[model samples]
Target: MKLVNIHTLIFILLFIIIGLNTAQAQVWSLQQCIDTAQVHNKNLQMNRNNISIGEQKEKEAKANLIPKITVNADYKYFSNLPYQLMPLSTFNPTAPVGQYKEAQFGVPHNINANLQLSMSLYNPQVYGAIQTTKIASELTELQYLKTEEQIFFEISNLYYNAQILHNQLAFIDSNLINAERLLKNMQLLNEQLLAKGTDVSKVKLQIAQLTNQKESISSKYEQVLNALKFAMGVSIEQKTQIDPNIQFKRANEYTSSTILDIRIIKTQNRLLSSELSTLNKSRFFPSLNIIGIYGTTGFGYDKQPNDFLKFFPIGFAGIQLSYPLFNGTVTQRKINQKQFELQNSELQFGLLTEQNNMQVENAKLQRMVAKKAVETTTEQIELAKTIYEQTVLQQKQGTASLTDVLLADNALREAQQTYLSAVIDYLKADLELKKLTGNISTTK
Candidate 1:
């Protein structure tokens, strides 16, 4: 039985270890990173929360049309009864017309309780507020979409940067291998006194330099990964890996008349216009409200407590009408101020449109330049590789010098690096173009 128990424990431990390894091996693709960021990013979540608040405000505006009910209760005790004046001629015929008598009346304690209900029957302001809140809600939704687009762009850029660094590291590794092979061959030649020791030393130095570059690139790759994790709202302490396969391709042309920012601004302007209109209508039109109250009043005297308290029921309902006749031209001045705001909104929209056009044009030009650079560098790398290979063969045949081989190798490395840079630039420019044209959100 003890042996069986030990075996079971071992199996459990093995299972747990395997599970941890699997968890740590999880990899995220570009799409997954963007999707995760949309859900987990703090700023996006806050913007979504604002949409919820806007929805609540809309509900509140609708609720204003419903009746409101309230209950109130009060208790009062008068140490001294209130006084009243009456003409004295009622009791005495000889009393002068101006003569009067003073007397105190009413109970020493009183209690009142009431329930009141009120509702707006006809208020233009309330209607206008409903419209305004609806537009505001739409604006919140647009804001969230805008934030989502921004996150997508940011994640794409970070992913591209990481892939570029990975490519650079691979390039360095390949060069290092070639350098080591050359160094070994030079050493063999040195043993036979056919090659100088300095040649071998130069190749060794080249290998060391490549190794240092690889280390630097590796560190940069890790930093990029950390940044990606931060953007995805993942825990920095957790081990996360991104898919290393990245491809660069030209994006389809996009032409949008309006971007997300423009839409949001227009919605804001509509809300403002609604507000101004409501203000104007309110100043000219009257508002109507219905009010009703039901309650009982109680009266009692401490000296006549045995008589008990008496209660009287009362109730009343009425409609009220209010109109703003004049307020020192305040309403007109407010309308003018709102009109100015609307004009400013329009001006801002025009300015933003011009800026967006410029961005799109600039990104297109940049992408074109980068594409050309990539093509040129790709050819350069091929030619440099051919030259390097031929130089190595000639060196073995006692024709080419060591300097020719080293220069060719360096040229090849430079070409590879230039190609990598061009690729990254093209990717960034494409992303920028997508963003400017409002295609980032729709493009996967």
Candidate 2:
């Protein structure tokens, strides 16, 4: 008896420990999940890399204005050739027409080395390059921001879908519990000769149906959980519960005046406009450059004592002017192409503005409709719950049939689920409004 009691105590303690551990697991909130996803997502990180590359391009644009310097060196050996020398009477006059004195003849070996520096004094190409790179950086930045927005959109939908599945599962669990209770009650009543065998079979069938419903909902819930984990970049081997506190805050709290406008894209378009203006200016302005070179070369015989003549440091400084004189009408065609592109961009921008307006209007209408749905569903749930409680109590008093009680229970569960769905829809619409208006905090 003592050993059996000790074993029972140990078993109870183990059960308690398991329950405590299960209860101690943490539940992640929606914002926390989104933050985790943004931190760990591979594609978002790649977009960030693209942004860094754009910054490097911006650095390159700045570097274009800096001067460039280079060094050059060469060596040569001549065994026998027409050596060069100063204007001296040549002893080899009879040997060749232009041959000089053997002593005055240039050296048979030569080496030349020099350093040269050049800076762009005035070059339209440089200006155009700078402007183009700046625009490219801005465009890349916009693309990164757009990528972030898209991730947020996808994550939000996945998170909400998981929540919806969770609620549906809760409904199924509740229904399953009710069905099991009804089956047990019918079984007991039949044993006491107060219920028919047919009643027991009917309750068993209800339990079976509820079991199938639970299984179906469980499958759907697993699918939704997997999708949510995927969006959050969580591993399949990991297990985590979601917090149900998404209902703690209303969408009104996240809404503000700043959350109602989409002006960033417009700002980018203006930058593009400035870029196009710079490109147009580039077409007419010719480039100006200053070129200067200093070097030394020699070919003489024992003239300067270094196996070569004196390193006559040659230097030339000059200004070069160049312009696109003509190119099969390409320049004019390019200008026309740019004009057409600008027109198309303007039209697209206008269309985007109109679309954004429609989105905002639609979102607002959806939120309003969803709000009404929540209100209506809330009232319906209250009425259904009242009816269910009354019907169940009447059944206990033998004043209502089992079917009436079951119908009332199902109706209440459906109304509750409908309310939850409406609430989720409202929240999603509110998020859409914020996203469309560029109001969501995207710093992460």
Candidate 3:
């Protein structure tokens, strides 16, 4: 019985060890996470498919200007009927006794195989369509680029979030260790009668609170890890750790106000203008295309050897001319519609540029202010630490109370937490500024 129990314990221990190893194997770097998300994100894939669809539309528009051909087969049967070109006594002589027939014909089949060509000889709409489709294709390509930008933005933010959580967890662990040490020191003081029962109880209570805090933080860390896995397109069963040491480097690169602030919107505005130009040109000229046709036809009405044995090949060539004179003001309405769209696009572009400028300004200001806050908070943490140590020594000499020491310790902890959080905010904001400047991916 003792051997069985030992074996069972050993099995459980080995299982836990193996599980930890398996979890560690799934850790992903930031770049790997971004690449994985790009591959698996459904929205990005949908945008990619739109690009292909645009290309297909361009191809279809070009194909419309090409000639088309077809083949046809038809069969017909006729019953008794009055004959116009036959003699009056040409009734069927082989008819039954009481039956009379004016004319009779067997089943006849007509076959027509024609390679017909119909090209746009004079159609402004098709001509405009090809150019518009090309522009549309370009627009789709831009949309793809826009999607990539958004994905990178999301990945950057999420990756930073995971790092923040890891840092928080580390802070919590450090606090836990400090609290446990304090508890042991309080136990020694109590045995020596240097501290009262209330002091010991206070230290124990602090330790318990810290332990609870650690548990709470561990739970939150697990939640953040799950979110990170989702962002990385990994399974929930995977566990991973992020490198908190990866810091954003400040650069004297070109300011966002100078460039990269409005280029994206500018690209869209240009594409829209291109569309308007195409629409305006559609009203003036007609498209031109050459059409060719070659085929054979058979009437099959006659069983003559000449008709049945010969393939009736016929060919015809012609040019089609079409001019849109007027339609209940359709062309005028279309032109007005396009003009309105162009106006709206211009307005939207202006608004976007303004927003981008505002974002650049705000990011710059926040970055500067956050940098100062980090510096101030670092000093505050150090001062708080010193004050807490002095308060503890004074309490040991009976000159300070438990409340003063507890207050001082709490202040130090708060200061430390604030300083750590400030650092994270500053770094994350810096990265965001870089993203707004369109340099998120430049840092390898």
Candidate 4:
């Protein structure tokens, strides 16, 4: 008995310590999760890398104007010295007009080396490319911001879902407590001969059902939390919990202005226009480059007293102008294709504006309807709880049957479900509304 008592005491202490640790675990707020994801989410990090890559591309464009220097070298040796033909008249002043002598002209070894440079004096393509990359860099930043908004949207949705599950689990726990209390009361009445055994059985069945419901809800809650943790870019093993409080208020009408999508399209249009301008320039405006080179040619021979190695110096500077006289009309084809794309993009811009306006209106109406449902369901929950309590009291007083109490419990459960549905609808509609208005990026 002494040993059993010591073990029991240790078990109780361990349970208390575990409970304390769980109670102290950090509960992440919605804003906290969003902020953490901004730094850690894999998708967002990739977009940041793309932004850096775009900046490098802009720098590369500017580098086209800088002078380029290169060194070249070559060496060759002839196994059989190459022969050359000389006029026979050089030896015998009037030999035959058709006669000739063969001679070998230089050393068997040869080498050439040079350092050359070319700098652009005026280049339409380089200047035009610089302008295009500037706009492209802006597009890259907008793309990153677009990705950020998408992350915010996903994380917010997961958190809201977790909160809904949390509330449902809370409701199940409340129902379980009520069912257990009723079971105890029915058992007492059965023993005192005031209630039949079937009454006790009904309450037991109710308690079992509530227990099953609680287990299912708890499992769903755990799954939702796991999903939330993944969205936060934290380890699935992380002990993550969302704030149980879901804050919402009726939102006012959102005004429309320039949105990110339109801005991105506008930047794209500018880039296309700049490229077309470059293409047109290529057809007419010529490019000029300043060139400079300094090098030497070497000759080497090895045999007897006349063996020698010699180097000859060479240098020159000049300007080169290039003009594209013609192609198979390829540049014209590109300009035509680009022109069509620009027109389509402009049309898409207007189409998106109209679509966004329609969605904004729809979201506003949905939120208002859900807001009304939430208000109505809240009152229904209160009334249902009151009826449930009165029915329980009546059953205990012998004025109502066990079936009446069960009916009241079912009514209470239905009201609770209706309330949850309304709240979720309101939350989802509000999220959609914020997204449509382009305010999601600015959302906290």
Candidate 1 matches the true fold with a TM-score of 0.91
What C-alpha lDDT do the candidate models reach, one value each? 0.90, 0.74, 0.70, 0.89
Residues 80-135 of candidate 3: C-alpha lDDT, one tens digit per residue = 33354444435655545654444544325545677767767656566667877887
lDDT of 3 at 88: 42
Comparing candidate 1 with candidate 3, which one achieves the higher lDDT?
Answer: 1
- Evaluated at residue 195, the lDDT of candidate 4 is 90
Return the candidate ranking by TM-score, descending.
1, 4, 2, 3
Estimate the TM-score for candidate 4. Answer: 0.89
Residue 108 lDDT, candidate 2, scale 0-100: 70
lDDT tens digits, residues 281-352, model 4? 877899999999899999998889888999999899999999988888998999899899889989988998
Best by TM-score: 1
- The collision pairs in model 2 are 105-301, 106-299, 106-300, 106-301, 107-300, 107-301
Q: Candidate 2: how large is its RMSD?
A: 6.2
Question: What number of clashing residue pairs does each candidate have, in the order they appear?
Answer: 0, 6, 0, 0
Residue-level lDDT tens digits of model 1 in 230-348: 99988888797777676877556877657899999899899889999999999999999999999999998777546558999989999999999999999899999999999999999
- Count: clashes, candidate 1: 0
Cα lDDT tens digits, model 2, 206-252, are 77887787788778867776777777777865676776545623446
